[model samples]
Target chain A: MSASDVTRAIRRMAHEILERNFGCVDVVIVGLQTGGVGLAERLVDDINEIEGTEVPLGSLDATMHRDDFDLRPITSEAATTIPVDPTGKIIVLVDDVLYTGRTVRAALDAIHSYGRPKAIQLAVMVDRGHRELPIRPDFVGKNLPTRRAEMVDVNNDGVDLGEIS
Target chain B: MKALRHLLSMDDLDRDDIEYLLDLTERYVEVSERKIPRIPALRGKTVALVFFEDSTRTRVSFATAAGRLSADTLGFDVGRSSVNKGESLRDTIETISAMGIHCIVLRHFGAGAPWRVREWTDASIVNGGDGRNQHPTQSLADLFTARQHLGDLDGRRIAIVGDIKNSRVARSNAIGFSKMGAEVIFVAPRTLLPASLEGWPVKVTHNLDEVIESIDVCYLLRMQLERQNDAAVPTLREFHHEFGLTTARADRLRDDALIMHPGPMNRDVEIAGVVADRPNAVITEQVSNGVAVRMAVLFVLIGSRLDLVEEQSAVA
Candidate 1:
């Protein structure tokens, strides 16, 4: 995927989000920590451009809610900032890629501690097919079939696929 | 980077480590400010608070920190537990670790208790307050509090007054402050001073009034009457007259100087009652910062290690 392809995908996703939520009212965007933060910010900018209004934006760190916490080494945590009340609002969780669906699950658990939202929807830049959990993205920029050993790198430049080796 | 397994002393951490923990503490402080001041950082993990010595602040702070991180806290009761049945410290620690605890916050009457416990358990050990040896977390919180009030600790003058010989807080704070580029001065009577400041990087002074003007932080350590004998001080009144932070002495201190005490203060003895309540006093802030600092320590020791591993695997 090229830079133009990424931009076109984001524009389409932004339009779909605005259409589904009827002009983005009561809709808040939360980007997952690290990779998803940039995408979430971009989405918020795109949505504001279309709707002529600002959407509540936040960044979530799901490290604490991960199931394999004890099985893996510890990592430095990023900040989780929700500037607005998530209760009675629609939470749109944004991430760079969708792989095992475990991260989305963790995000779901994490958001509960903040406040109970009316609904939560997942948005991803790339939907790589290999989900361990029964999770699906509400807005997908690209559906890229991937092998378990392959890695997907998504950034402003584009999305690139590489093998683990 | 790999996370630390145990915090035996301030020596285990460099300036970077201290700064990292302090920076991480800011995030925890933010978490504390939230409507729900709890995080799932340590969910499904268990921490044991083993206090062989009686404590009110350190013990409660560690427990509260663990709870705030969503970790189950197991309080080891030395009064009613098998410890009273003459069970060895090693055995007690091993028993706790055998129960599948993830971390141990240890406070023992013996110095180096946490270090010795490290040998018996694979679980990470955080030193709460060991016998006149080191209280690394307390120093971390103290540094955090000092930095909050004094801005930067670099080139800051801190005088740790009273009971230097039997203060784990003093030992830890001296190392921590020096590591962070602060100059430490020990102000106490000769009998209260340690016999040797040979390798210790701090100055010694017998006069409180002489150094009060130049110091940025006057950190007062509790006079452990239980730990001292008659030889340590001639009389309480004489000690108060000579080295105590009396109201008159406090008046002589610089307006910007901070008055700090590691609590349960002997009122009008080491510090005047009114002085502790002054605006320059950050004693309460230090207590609150203790929880944040401990939360940072536990998070790094247990949760951050996973992050390191993930980064390494990604690089591989």
Candidate 2:
């Protein structure tokens, strides 16, 4: 996927969030660390343009709460920023790829560590259908049928594509 | 899912269990000196950390040990979660267990809280710490340190001083020390020692100077200001005068005798600064051994699929 394709998909996912939520007042878009935060910021910008109002944006480092942290050392250097009150405000959790849903699980746990959000909805760039959990993305940009061994890399800044090793 | 196998509390660990963990720790301490110090035992396994209290040392050490063995780690702090919103501890643990977490490392401020968590979760539990009742890991590390110094635990005189009744360190150390064939003497004021000592296999004394002179190993426990339940708590100055291991007290011990503390020391309250930093002091060694001991504990409890590592060791 090209950078243009990535932007278009995020814009689409942002619109779906607005349409489903019936507007998004006091709504905050929080991206999971590294690549997800970049995409989340872009989505927040796109959503602001569509609604003709500023939408808050945030980023999170799920390093401390990562399941694979003990297996794989934390590499992300991104900082967390939650601008809106998580309590009673709608939180749109953004991530690059939804695989076995473990990263999402860690991200949710990390977000809760920061503050309590009244409601949290997950949005992802790629819905690689091998979810180990019962979770499904609330706003999915594209559903790519992926094998168990394949890894998806969504460059929220440059190219967005699922690469099979 | 065996409830007893879960190490959510000190009560879960009896004499044999402690011995097994100690034996495993000895093996791992040796294995850590190899060229590549890691095992593949916990591969594809996950250990969740539900830390209600913040701990830098324990968290990092456990994470590093787990990573060396290729196990996944899930850690969460409680402040931002439903835990802060009045969610029951059992409910939180049950939710994580449902996610297929294989093991849990929990630390709480209330005694027996981990037991409550065990009631709701099937994951094998390692009690990082819970209230003032116990910090088994610290004691395990302490035992490892003692074994390293004395070469053996048999016929060793281990003296534990200060905040005897209030300190989980003292409690766990007394049990572990005595179990390992060391004669442990609890040195503290009558007010400090628990009123009832029916089952403890240790001698009680109020004379720090006399006990300090006799022991081969002097383990000083910090006098916890946090645990002082009353405003009439003894002043640090008066406490030190009575029980602190001053330089004068250190001189009373044999030349080869070892001194140790669990860290975050109070200087003169339970131990003197120089004594804690003395050449005989193994406090730093204790901290370093903490990682190795925890590595062994995590490996054994979690079963990190480490047949390859042991096979490699055999060939070496």
Candidate 3:
């Protein structure tokens, strides 16, 4: 996927989110740290520009809520910051890629700690299916099917599918 | 993540290590503020609290930190345990290690007990408080609290006032603050001052008035009623007049100067009761930050994955 394709997908996703939610009432956009932060910012910016309404933006690092901590170290470099209380609000969780579904699951666990949201919808730039958990994204930028051993890279440049080694 | 086998002293950490741990401490602080203030960072790991001495805050703090990380904590009570039956420290440590624990948070009246215990157990050893030696986590908490109020401790002035000779907090914090580029000043009477200050990176002053108004932090040490038996001063009243953060002395402090105490404070002896209630006094914050700091320390030291850079020995 090219940079222009990623921007176009974000613009379309912003439109779909408003249309699905029926006019974007009490909508809060939270981007996962590192990868999804830029995408979420762009998504919120596009949504606000299109709807002519301001939306709250926040970022979360779901490292602490990870279920496989017994298998890896907890790196808490980036802090989780939610500007407003999420109680009874529609939270649009944005991420760069949807793979394994573990990160999204951990992010769900993390968001519940702050407050009970009215609902949560997942947005992803790329959906590379290899889910170990029953989780799905509500919005997707690109659908790239690959082998289990392949790696999907998402950045400002583009999305590249390649082997890690 | 930094590989650490044992956290025995403030000397074990460098400037970068302290900053890394304190930065992680900030993240833990955020975790603690949520509706559910617990995380499963160290699930299935066991942290044994092998405290050979009596304590209130340090013991509770470490146990709470381990629990927040979803690790099991087994507190070995000295009074009720085999210590009464004359079992050796080594024997106690071996017994705990045989059960396969991940860490041991120890507080013993003997100064070098954690080092000796580290030899007995494969688990990481954390010095909760080892005699008059060092309380690394307490100092870490102090640094974290200081950083919360002040940005970086690069040029801050800290006046550790009280019985410096008997304070593990003072000893550890002097090294810690200095490592962070803070100037440390020890204020105490002649009898309460340590015998040697040649190796320490601090300036010694017998009078609190000399640096009271100039310091960025006024750290008051709890009068060690149990440890100070040397007739350090004429009376408690005299000590209060001379060095205690009396209302007058508190008023003399800089408006932004932070007043701190390690805990179980002697309200009238070291710090006045009214003065402690002042906004500048972050005594409560110090105590609360203790949990977060210990959480960061424990998670960084032992809760790391097996594939990371695993190294032995502390006090680098």
Q: Which has the greatest TM-score?
A: 3
Please provide TM-scores computed only on chain A for all of the candidate models, following their numbering: 0.98, 0.88, 0.97
Task: Sort the predicted structures by TM-score, highest score first.
Answer: 3, 1, 2
| Model 2: CAPRI class | incorrect
Rank candidates, lDDT, best first. 3, 1, 2
Candidate order (DockQ): 3, 1, 2
Docking class for candidate 1: acceptable
> What is candidate 1's lDDT per residue for B264-316, written digit by digit as tens?
89988888889899999989999999999999999988766646665677898
TM-score of chain B of each: 0.97, 0.88, 0.96
What's candidate 3's DockQ score?
Answer: 0.60
The candidate 2 chain B region of ten consecutive residues with least summed lDDT is B1-10
- Displacement of the residue B181 alpha carbon in candidate 3, Å: 0.2
In order, the interface RMSDs are: 3.0, 15.5, 2.4
lDDT of 2 by residue, A1-165 (tens): 777877889889988999988998858899988768878888988998999988888886654455654443222124556675577788898988888888788777656644577789999888879888778899987788878777777773544444454
Off by over 4 Å in 2: A1-165, B1-4, B8-19, B34-36, B231-233, B304-316
Best by lDDT: 3
What is model 1's native contact fraction?
0.48
Q: C-alpha displacement of A88 in model 1, angstroms? A: 1.9
* Model 3, span A1-165: residue lDDT tens: 999998899999999999989978989999998789999999999999998988999999988778877665555558788988999999999999899999999899889988999999999999999899999999999999989889999988889999967
Candidate 2 structure, TM-score to reference: 0.61
